[model samples]
Target chain A: MSDTTESKRLTTAQDYASLIDKFDTFLFDCDGVIWSGPKLIPGVREVIAWLRTKGKNVLFVSNNASKSRPMYKKTFDDFGIDTTDDELFNSGFASALYLAKILNFPKDKKVYVIGMKGLEEELDAVGVAHCGGSDPAEMEYMPAKDYTSVTPDPSVGAVLCGFDAFVNYKKYSKAHTYLTKNPGCHFILTNTDATFPSGGEFYPGSGAMSAPLVYSTKMTPTVIGKPNSHMMDAILASKDFDRSRTIMVGDNLETDILFGQNSGIETLLTMTGVTNEDHLLGPKKSSTVPTYIVNSLGDFKVLVDESK
Target chain B: MSDTTESKRLTTAQDYASLIDKFDTFLFDCDGVIWSGPKLIPGVREVIAWLRTKGKNVLFVSNNASKSRPMYKKTFDDFGIDTTDDELFNSGFASALYLAKILNFPKDKKVYVIGMKGLEEELDAVGVAHCGGSDPAEMEYMPAKDYTSVTPDPSVGAVLCGFDAFVNYKKYSKAHTYLTKNPGCHFILTNTDATFPSGGEFYPGSGAMSAPLVYSTKMTPTVIGKPNSHMMDAILASKDFDRSRTIMVGDNLETDILFGQNSGIETLLTMTGVTNEDHLLGPKKSSTVPTYIVNSLGDFKVLVDESK
Candidate 1:
């Protein structure tokens, strides 16, 4: 184990010659890698422009499925970084595509969704079905935050999980009971972020909602957000891209590091996200180490430019 | 699902004619089915005598791996039922055998066991190696509770989880960390009983110790006890048993019923155990339901006598 002071004092920026020589595509995690909360990190725009001028592809990836692709593009544009819907990847979008491919979706395959407006809008754009009404026997129902309108049915094909403010104990208990009674039913959680930064203090993330079900039913959810390969696969299958030339950049180890490791992509870990130096030193440090560590997105660009 | 009242009313003794006709060897669950806590349930002794008189094989089976075979045998003998060590099947006993067979254990395999004196005795009797120290750094360590100890070496050959009194947060965090670092290391849990009855209150069981690791590492433990076929195979493989004729009788649906269901042996459900009418009406009450629902163990005598 490395000494704490030594690791912290070690410059996050170093020679990127080898790393730049190895990759063409750049994937950036939104929350910490590019911006903290709604504010853009310093020198993030310049790095994107540099990458674009170097003819490298850039994708703005986020595991927060609460936001749509358009929302992501808007956020990047608002932050003075150039991006488009085509260059955005959200787990909710990927999840919709995944379910669509497997279930042979109908315009009427009423999906019981539990998420924010962005997720619902994405589902609507995909022409997938949705159900959330007063009827208790309905085949589909959407529960967001409170989900007072939604009642569980054994026939509900799948339960979708995402970010929402209306969630409460009743919703969780119902989901638990329903899934317990019917183990064959599918459970799709957007992501497993334990806590997400809000105003001042940290608020519980989708992990809080999914943890109980996972514990009780002993089921591993098929996550469809940032750092998971599900989103990567959806993007690659839709676009004519070379996976070998792709490089993934993120700030969290469990999700981002794991995503890159599982997807066979080069990963650059940025110190701008939820995982701090202490977190790294803790037992949670992944066995799959990052290929590069950077203090900021500016450092990422320096490596890219210098390597070429 | 059937109403609770109706399900309760439906609980009645059925002739074990069909079940006895199918299998000759009988396996009984000790807790609830035969005894509750320290007291033997009514008619338990007569039933065993009747089965023995009819020349049917009987084995005392339980998921509680906290105690050794001799302890259970002693308990039964004290309760007016004569039994041999060979007739007892506990997860702890099976776990030692499993480690001995698969791991190429040395004469002194030096294990870190996190269970009771029974588990330690079983390992000693098998001539395998073990240490039952509380310190994480004291060689190999097993977790008897959700939190017990953590090893700093980051490399232990195996982690055994069983029954322990002092479970806390620190131990779980360390064990989970060690597991993440050394993915190849083995995990052995005595049983997966979510909660067991103790002192008129439900307390977390072996499942609590095993589950957290299983969730974090995404690695399932090599279970050594009930519902798992390893012990059954170990017992039937012994000199006194015949594979072609064995009957497993118990009360719990998920563990006992499913054990018999998967093992291709006839099963009987007694009304005196952990499971009740609620389980019979829930998902587990389908075609996999027990072949017989006897009011008490004494009913077994009638079946055996009739067979004679």
Candidate 2:
């Protein structure tokens, strides 16, 4: 499904209806497309409900590793949108599921998490014991002069990285030690999103947090998020989905549209978030071209009303 | 001066004497060439003393930004080596000098330091008031949710980074805010050394600390250290020296030897620190070839004794 000149802009209600009819499954990126932050986009809730009424499979795929699936479901519930835990696939949950179910992580071995509580909860839900994340001892600043206190944990089989607020020298020191000292220790990251938008400003994301460990160890991690096939693999493994009938809808082209292109899925770009009009048509436009472009997910509400 | 077969290995006392006589100035990298961590390498003190006795200019040039010149002089004093503050050139000092002397930093504006006391002291020494580095407020972990507290100081004209022990999200966020919000806020770093050796282990260095800001702001800093001409410029500006008659001696080829090569001076590789013999002779040999190689600086003690 290429973005031909005629099909690129879905300005008409008939265009929206026809595009919706083409796909059986819709993968949504939550932060930008459906909502900006705490507030919901005007017509997004109605459009999602309308999609469910049409018996379409709607799944929320997010690179936010700070929140678990259930936590994300709570946010959906608070927003008056009914979303099940099974319908949500976040990077944190994907990382845990990949380690536990796919890699068949040893029960005796533990994972060293350089992330937040959400990643820890996901790992716990999968019965995978973890250390370092939210650990009070690790949160305190440990100087390099006292690095002797940062002893190795032999039981740690994997070092997983995400957006960590308590990222310090100690955490990096221990993670580096684990990757180098432990033979065949797995190095995993949720996503390499360089910057994350929040409170109307961009801040350093998970990729920035993981850079110290990357530099110290000189080892690249297996990234399991958007633009990487691992998240799609986890989603595909959990449910039966046809690639030809699936469409990825997102606001950012780098992670969202690129993820869809990399996964061989059709993509839709919504202009309500990080991306702008010139991002696709500008001189410095990205290679990840979306099949369809819409002003907002709210624009598709016109199609639902027309069908009614 | 290039690495000829005869001068590659200074095995004999006569070879050592000839090599010492070849240069009027000797720039030494402290870590791997002179000593490793708290322990001093054998014969290094004697050779340094012998070089001073020959009326040759001896300068201790290091990328270690964790300590100030006075603090570093204390280390030399502890090692029983008589050295003046003017004889030392470190990254922290270079960064401060680069901003104050070369860049002509605004006297009204302040610098935001994302490093330790050493870097802060250097900045203070130059009459440049700075915030963040070693500041108790910046040391604490500031969560992404409460980024509102990361208020930007409009008076901040620069964000200088080095090997910071207290690197956290707060520092990166504040630096990002300053770089993005302030019109002409400078982004400078002491060095981009990915990792530094300490106690037989490689730890995240200055580059790692600056990465988060680099990722968030998408800005490159003016790096002032080895392998860059800013540090050499500072050295040359402060003292009279003949570039043709000067030689750089270090254990690492990437930084120290590369520094010499980039600065158009002769370089000698010592095998006692971070690099090995195969590093130069193997398939992955660095492009920055050294003019000479020695087993250790201790071998030069033979030359000291021969002079006696």
Candidate 3:
């Protein structure tokens, strides 16, 4: 436990109810904060519904670039949570938004993608033209030492990297060639998460998938994910939200708590995901402490019971 | 061009002869110093054979790990240069030697390889049992989000990374899982060369291939290649060579010349490959200045002319 961070712990139903009442907007992170895997964390859906009933705005800000907004909606529906497409702001959408709005990417140029179909969908949503991602040609394993086909495409003005299950050397070589050979080519990364928890284990994340391109190209990507300020800037640009009245609730300290802190918003740490009490109280206390800590986001289900 | 570096330039045949006479042994980088693409650099063969006739030791020390020693020997034969298997010290062979001699890799445990057949052959020569390299299953495009097949194998004691045209997400997940789950698993890299010149263009190198695993696993590999001194250490342990009488000749300053400098030996830079005159005397002057400079190693053919 580090004395540097004085975090308030919510225990009773009054504390949970009081905490929710303070913010008009609540930002939730999906994986560990709402649902661990396939099942929804007990009481989370009830708490979210209760928050909505109180006219509180809720947004799901996730670093999971693997899923586009509509794909995430399906996951929400599968979990029996009523989440609309408009309330989600994932890294994939943020990346596309950054290219379309912030950079004002040329309409004629295309983005070389090193990601999944979800990322491509987001690019398409923003009317940003893209290539390579989830393309059957890019997924093919290039025969050893044959990179003649991996030449630079002049039409590619930017390289967008994210989570790609089909990440292969051909994609890396082509991305490297584009970033290196093409003048003024923007290197964009959805997020820099090292690993994503999947199927009861941590696998390579979107960041890991883009590491090779980063190494080979020797270019630093403009990360459009949490804690980078880009996502917050994008949200602020489009959505009308009072920053001071918003609270970010997530499981991971580095990604979630740090993101809120970077964006100048209040943050709540939930223990239902990647972090625990030891991370806040133990010898290796994380530097990024939250404004409030709770055993689980589901703890606020007591508010639902009170409503009944 | 920097005044901090007072390098001697060799021009005349007498100057080239004096430079070769000063060192009993020579370490040459293959790419630009010996050949460029499929064509052999003119006069390199004559210069090398002449150097051998004078009883001077010549070792081809290359960061190119795409080819094992035998494959390199075949290339040497194609170029009309008589280089024996023992005269080559590539990053691939250095990696195997490092594992067998320095680490004393356990015979029972296997190394999960993320490289090519050349890398596998080198590992085989050293008796390091390996899996995953060139495995057709590992190269297959794992249908999106299906990481169930990629599980932790306790038998994997080390993860050796090198250049693999077939490098895919399956290999990345497997390497990540092995390093994270397997206790005390060593991470090894053949070399950290960001790119390799092939077909007259630069492509992603061995280092880029392993970047994903390095990122996901959050592990620093023991790199057995140029500029790291691991290759020099391997050379010193296996061959009886005098450090004071050796000179490293290469085209690139970062990998080859810096490698020699790190090894406490003299370095000679040639102007036939990835570097040019501006690198030494331009606005973007490289910090790594070699001990000597030559227009090209083929310029040493002046010594051959003098002998004729």
Candidate 4:
């Protein structure tokens, strides 16, 4: 809002639509750009409908990996929109796909996941065998329950730390002790966010909690979330989308903006979730910047109509 | 085995007893020193018994905060050692205690935790109310999980990150988003071990996974683990222990030796855990060197007797 005229790069939704028409690739943030909280912003469905009418290719890129593709698909359906699993770009799906490609993560690999069902399904889709400590019979899947309980056998080759309800100091301490004792093991984490939005408040995320492990182990995680090319690489390999023709849009800077930057696609910023223009102009703004900005999806229709 | 003649620091068990008699307080690591992989290390029980016989004060300092004092007390009882809740020091406990002391963490203030039951107990002990999303059924207790699933509500004055199983990309992304959104929120963590000795091969610890959150938040966690002095502070606050008459023993360099150095207590390095003597005598050895070194707890006992 400050000094809007002083910038070399201030763009409107129309500019973004023209770029999308030219490039044929689109990426978007979920929370702020398309919707806020659970309610879809105005005109988003219509704008997408217009884009589909124009034969423009689009990929919804989100760093949010909490939900599965099926859930997202359902959400879109509920909103009177059409989206296929192949057309979606989620951090969890991308992460699993990449691990399968690069690390030869086998369908038979006994993956002990500490995440929601979304991640578990992704692993299942990849034919990766996994279990959580909660599954009574699968309790053996967990090696250490942080610092409190040692549930799984400590001899497993890898320990995957994700989002879970049972995270605690005892569990973490146990996990730390186990990992320290066995330095040769593999440690995989989904993302490093400190907190997330729910209902009307924020909650601590994996990033906030996982930071300590990074310091203790001196090992960087094989991050499978946005801004990293692992998910993009997997999406590109799927052949359902063309990389050069795709545009990425989102509200967040690090993941949503950087995803577009990393993928060489058009980026759009919506004033809906997690990020705003002030953040984009702030010092922490990464090397990646969105190609366009719109007040809301309702405004985006105007851009699409003008482009036509 | 290295050239002992050239070493300026004492590097034997006998050297340890003399140093122990000169110190007033003692700290010990839980994982490698007291027990490794569910089994107590050789002669550790005896050495501790000998310490008690000599009227030396002892403190069990662990970076793993997943467990509460009562839990440690049970473990000690299993190990044939008598201990009280105050004698057991964990990062989670210390972090809670320290936050309560400095910030006057309000009894009604909403504390968001990304940890386990032990962490919950600690927060409760300090008279703090917590909110998390993991268990909606616990709504009577504010049924909130960590801050990962929700937005940073202004009502949340403090955010605590610890070991969590539901640590995922969305959570990580959300945590980062919230911290960036609200910079005034107090950020706290249990420990920074890169990897702890999990029962199996090494996996990611809290420190490694929490790196991104720490970076994004631009806040350094007030560590409650060994070497941070929070545990020592807790020990000193107890009526039974005298700070000037205690000592510390462990195998890890950073946790054990560093804890002793930081707390102004004598330190003894055991050759049973994460670090070896080579590291202590290597080029990386700082002025904060251990006062003595021993091969095992058996040798430590002999040194103690000889000093007597």
DockQ-superior candidate, 2 or 3: 3
Q: What fraction of the true interface does each of the listed models get right, in terms of native contacts kept?
A: 0.01, 0.61, 0.89, 0.33
DockQ of each: 0.03, 0.66, 0.76, 0.25
- For candidate 2 chain B, the 10 contiguous residues with the lowest summed lDDT are B1-10
List the candidate numbers ranked by DockQ, top first. Answer: 3, 2, 4, 1
- Candidate 3 — which pairs collide? A1-A281, B1-B280
- Residues A1-308, model 4: lDDT tens digits: 44342212425764555555566756666677777887988888888888777787767766566677887888788878778887776777776776676667644346556556777787778776665523433322232444335444445445566555444333444445545555455667777666666666555565655555556656667776777766677777564666667767677777777767776766666666776666767776445557766555567677657756
Which 10 consecutive positions of candidate 4 chain A have the poorest summed lDDT? Answer: A1-10
Which lDDT value does model 2 have at A209?
A: 90
User: How well does candidate 1 score on lDDT at residue A107?
Assistant: 52
A229-277 per-residue lDDT for model 3 (tens digits): 8998877756788999999999889998999999999999999988977
lDDT of each: 0.65, 0.87, 0.88, 0.65
Ranking by TM-score: 2, 3, 4, 1
Best by lDDT: 3
TM-score of 4: 0.70
Task: List the candidate 4 regions with Cα displacement exceeding 4 Å.
Answer: A1-21, A99-111, A123-130, A133-190, A206-219, A240-245, A282-287, A303-308, B1-220, B239-247, B272-274, B282-288, B294-308
TM-score of chain A for the candidates in order shown: 0.79, 0.94, 0.95, 0.80
TM-score of chain A of 2: 0.94
Cα distance off (Å), candidate 2, residue B249: 1.3
Q: Please tell me which model should have the higher lDDT, number 1 or number 3.
A: 3
Which is the winner by DockQ between candidate 3 and candidate 4? 3
